[model samples]
Target: MSGRFQAAAPKAPSTLEKITKSPLFTVGLNTAYFVAGIAFIQSPLMEMLVPQL
Candidate 1:
């Protein structure tokens, strides 16, 4: 009975490598996500409070 658990090696990077390499890209992504999230949260409340015209 000789069974040992071995950890797998880490995988290599793919296309996402460029985003991680640039600070501007990350900032832009964060900003877009923030704006989108705000819009998402507001849309439902707006529809509920405002009558359809």
Candidate 2:
């Protein structure tokens, strides 16, 4: 039992860890995805509605 507990102890994270570990990274990623989705929605609609000039 004590051996299992020792084995399960948490290890420290190494350097070069991902910036996405932070809340700011998550927000930035979500914002980028939202903007991309809006652009995707608009592009096809604009092309279809505006045919030529």
Question: Best TM-score goes to which candidate?
Answer: 2
| lDDT digits (tens) for residues 1-53 of candidate 2 | 45554457777766535565878888998999999988977897767877685
Model 1 Cα shift for residue 24 (angstroms) = 0.4
Q: After superposition, how far is residue 19 of candidate 2 from its true place, in Å?
A: 0.8
RMSD of each: 6.1, 5.1
- Superposed by TM-score, candidate 1 places the C-alpha of residue 51 at a distance from the truth, in angstroms, of 19
- Candidate 2 backbone overlaps, count: 0
lDDT of 1 by residue, 1-53 (tens): 35977779998777689667789888988999999989977887767877779
TM-score for each predicted model, relative to the true structure:
0.46, 0.53
